[model samples]
Target chain A: MRSLVQALGLALSDYRHEALFSACSVFVLAAVLAPLMVLLGVRNGVISAMTDRLLRDPRTLEIIPVGSGKYSPEWFRELAARPETAFVVPQTRSIAATISLTNPNRPNLGLNVTRIVATAPGDPLLERYGLPEAGFVRDEKSADPLYPAPLVIVSASVARKLAVPASPQELKDPAGYWLEGRVERVLQGRREAAGINLRVAAVLPPEALGVDAVFVPLEALAAAEDYRDGKNAPLFRALAAPRAEKRSEKAVTPENFEDYSASLYREREYASFRLYARSLDAVEPLWKWLAAREVEVYVKVEEIEAVKSLDHAFSVIFGLITGAALFGFAASTAGNALAGVRRKSRSLGLMRLLGFPGAGIVLFPVVQSLLTAFSGAMLADLLYLIVAFAIDSLFSASLPGKAAVCSLSPGQTLAVFAAVLAVSALSSVAAARQAADIEPSEVLRDV
Target chain B: MAAPAPIVLALRGLRKDRRTERAEHYSLSVPALDVRLGEKILISGPSGAGKSTFLDMAAMALKPDAADEFFFFPGARAGDGRACDIAAAWTRKDIERLAMWRKHIGYVLQTGGLLPFLSAEDNIRVPSKLLGLSAQKDKTARMAARLKISGLLKKFPAQLSVGERQRVAIARALAADPPLVLADEPLASLDPENARTVLDMFMDNIEDAGTTLIVVSHATDLMENMDFRRLILETGARDGKAFAVLKEGPG
Candidate 1:
């Protein structure tokens, strides 16, 4: 015990005795560790921010179309039957028609066409999109043009462009210059759009909308197109066929939807479908199952890197910057430490005479490196948090509600700290080799 | 009590050389030599007579360039009956034997070889520590008392005068209480009085321990007080041949 303590004390005292060597080691450690620590923080910040944003809108993980076409209704129904499957629904996307809402006194100005998407009532996508429930009654006396069986939610930009009145009485009164109508909710999509009220039912985050975009119930839209509501429009019914076993001879394809919709009077086979699973892991196997049925279906999965191009770019930039910083650190630190070790060769000679092993001399620089790196990492991580929070608060970016709450997990911190220490320790290997090369004979000679 | 067995150390026809003009060239040889236990032998010669070189060979720190046999009793022999022929051990496991041999046979260099970082006392304790001495305080105090370096214990080698540093070196040489001591012009840098003072201290401590001492010196006065055996080196016609003329000291 005494020997062990003595060895440690001697090692510690030896570090102090060689001031230049210790300083060089510590400087190198700090150099390598500071940028490495900063890189760790940057990775943590970007990953955490993306995760928070995606998680806040649960529908970010939905399998939306990358190209044309969608999954078969029968395939979707089969997937929905599985215990792991969470939710399954159909969606149709199209451009909203440019319709004129004229003002009698002023010259007409052209408005941008709105984007229209069809969805079901009480769908999981509504909450994921931050949309209020359907049937959010705006006014009782309103004879709104956009509502009846086919309800629509319009972008706030559209409402302002068409000069829609704020209330039912305002629209009805002579000053309103329009008939009373029920407003569903405001669409708060991020992209550009013109005002044309489809009756805003729920206001979404700005990222959700585009142009003069609107969301309408699938059934009502189908009914209106079929002219069922005393207007000339088409009607279509979404349906699913019985699940086909693997042994069956009827090969499923795009022609099937057309044939089935035409033949079946009561049920119209849907052209597209979306299959949901309990988690991301189940997606691959289910996709294979559909493929086995000879159904020409393509699948897509959601990862944070998918929609967040900015985050991926941030990661690459961070890595390059961190690497360059560490290189400068290793150069300056290792050079200084080696010089220090060479200067103290005589003192080291005395220690050798005092019964210290050749390996013990290396310990002096190694300990100093470890201490500096740990402290530097903690400092960098603290600075990262302060910067991330300050930016989020200042910009008021609908950046994601949880951006302020972003944080690195314990596993992440441990890995980064260990990596920095390993690099710093490696820088001392040259100094250790120099210390080991001392010849006691040289010390005894008259220098 | 039975007579204590005599430990004998000898050198015979020892030849050593250096490479001259990139060709191996033989330089000198001592034909025969012998010393019994507890006998002081002073080697005297003109400049370039290889006195220090010979001392190094005797101390086991250097190997002879050429030799028929070099032998030490109380040591194991090789198949050729030569102690020098035995393979040297340098590994950590054999370091104890190496250190023990080194501690017992001390070398006082011409220049003060005291470790610069250590004070006078720590330098004295070097061999003691190497020999695994735990009661360092007692050993240091005892050596300081004998060598009269008690007041200079805390002073570094640089701080001490030339004579004082040599005294510290002698104390270090005697630290392990070795059976033999070797000094190469130990008083070379000191004034006459300081040199004699150092010589007197060395003689008293070594006589009390009954340890054999070998001193290589230029001055005859340092050798007068003690009864010593002398080996004088005289060059011959051939480069490899040298005669060692032996003479008895005043008894």
Candidate 2:
């Protein structure tokens, strides 16, 4: 220990004169690792953020057809009866005729595609998708009086695009425009799902429901589509009833009555069945089972896995790049350390003649190199932090916010530091060979 | 007085070679000789009489071109295959024999081979440091003072006048207080006054310490008044013959 300290002292006392070389070594080491550290941190932060959003939302379990399919509603209900089932809901897509107030004299000409997601009353999945309450929208009389309009939930962007230009107060009047609809809700938190307006609801976070899809009742959507043909498909009538009623109380039923009589109906119109599951873990199995039961289904389990794997891949890639950078830094530091020792051969000879052992002589350069490397690492870390913050401020993106929290685990940092120090120290050892063989006879020679 | 115990440093059957007086000749037939401690020995002869060769052999710094022969010097113990530690003569295990040997032995020549980088004091301290001598600082300061080089301790060899450099070399040779000091030609690079002063310092200190001194010089007149045993080498027909003279007292 004493010998090691003595060697370190010598190196420190003498190496100060070579400021440029020492500084260059430090900069080289830091340059190699700083970029890797920042990139890894940023990648980790973004991936974690995405994963957190995905995990916070409830996973979709099963999807049932309310418009066209080979299976009757009874089949869907029967499949939903499995012990592994979570929630079974009917869904469909349709286009609704949109009228422009400025051009109302011509006719309601604009048509927009919409997703009609039908849920049973108090369905847990309704909250999962950030949907409005079942009775949030009520029937309202129109100015024309001839055509009664169904309640509609429009995306905020769609609302703006469809509504005629008006002052803020006038825009809020609800009846100022011919397409006047109640401002039931405003979606927040996610940009992708913004600009959506629910009749009596606030907008859902964009990440929760995705793009601005218009929401309408299943029966309403089915009725709207009935104009395409003389009669609506039996699958629609079977799955779009707003309420469930007993067969004994029904005056009439669809042609597939015998095939789906036992199926429950909801709101005396569209029917809904609650799929009870023993546990959340079994939801996927239930989905697959229903899918095999001649029912069209959508599985959310795969979606969650997809999001998880994507985040994992991001982290892995960052790690690989960081590892490569650290390796390169280690190599550079090692080379510099070795060269520094080689350059001091004569100085080392003097020490040996002064009675220092081989190991003692080697210790000076090793300790010196390690000290330089550590100081470089600290400087690099500080500079990287500043850069991260600067980037965040320059762009109004989420990058800056996430960068502030970018950090590596203590174990990882220590491992990297240890590796760098070891490599540098070893390089110095390699250069100490010349010092190991000094002959005492040199001091007695004439010159 | 009873015969003093012989302080023998013998070179048994030592031989040399020459072919028509050529430098690279490898033939051998020279006679062996012995040296005693406390004796100031000189090998005076013509240029080709092998005076330097004999000195090199006696100092153990060089080997003969060809020969397998027995050898003995002042400090070689029985069964010992190596030279003695002249520097740290008192410390055996503490100071390695080879290191002490190198440190203690001092050699000077006509060209003044004092290290160019060091001052006179540092050059003298070099052997002490190598021998692990703890009293080097005191010894170096004292030697520099004794040689009147106290003020010149920081001056480099190149900065010193020729005579001053020779004196510094002499001071360095004596700084470690070694048992054996060898001078190929101590006065070769100095003026008469400086050579006399330096020779006086060497003789005065050598007598005080009873240390062995061997000098190879061509100036027989300068050596006339010195109290040293002279060995004159005869050339050609009698190349190996060495005649010894003891100036001490009826020896």
Tell me the alpha-carbon RMSD of every candidate: 11.9, 14.2
Residue-level lDDT of model 1, residues A98-207, one tens digit each, is: 23233333335334344444555445556555555543223222344232332345555555565544343443343324212121211232222122223345534445
Clashes of each: 22, 34
Across A338-438, the per-residue lDDT of candidate 2 in tens digits comes to 77766665556445443345666677677678777887777677777776676546643644233334555667567657776777777767766544544
lDDT of every model, 2 decimals = 0.54, 0.53
Query: Which regions of candidate 2 fall more than 4 Å away from where they truly are?
Result: A1-13, A16-324, A353-355, A374-397, A400-413, A438-447, B1-140, B143-251
Q: Each candidate: fraction of true contacts kept?
A: 0.08, 0.02
Off by over 4 Å in 1: A1-13, A19-36, A39-62, A65-204, A209-321, A328-341, A344-443, B1-16, B19-37, B46-50, B54-87, B90-105, B155-159, B232-251
Clashes of 2: 34
Q: Of the candidates shown, which would achieve the greatest TM-score relative to the real structure?
A: 1
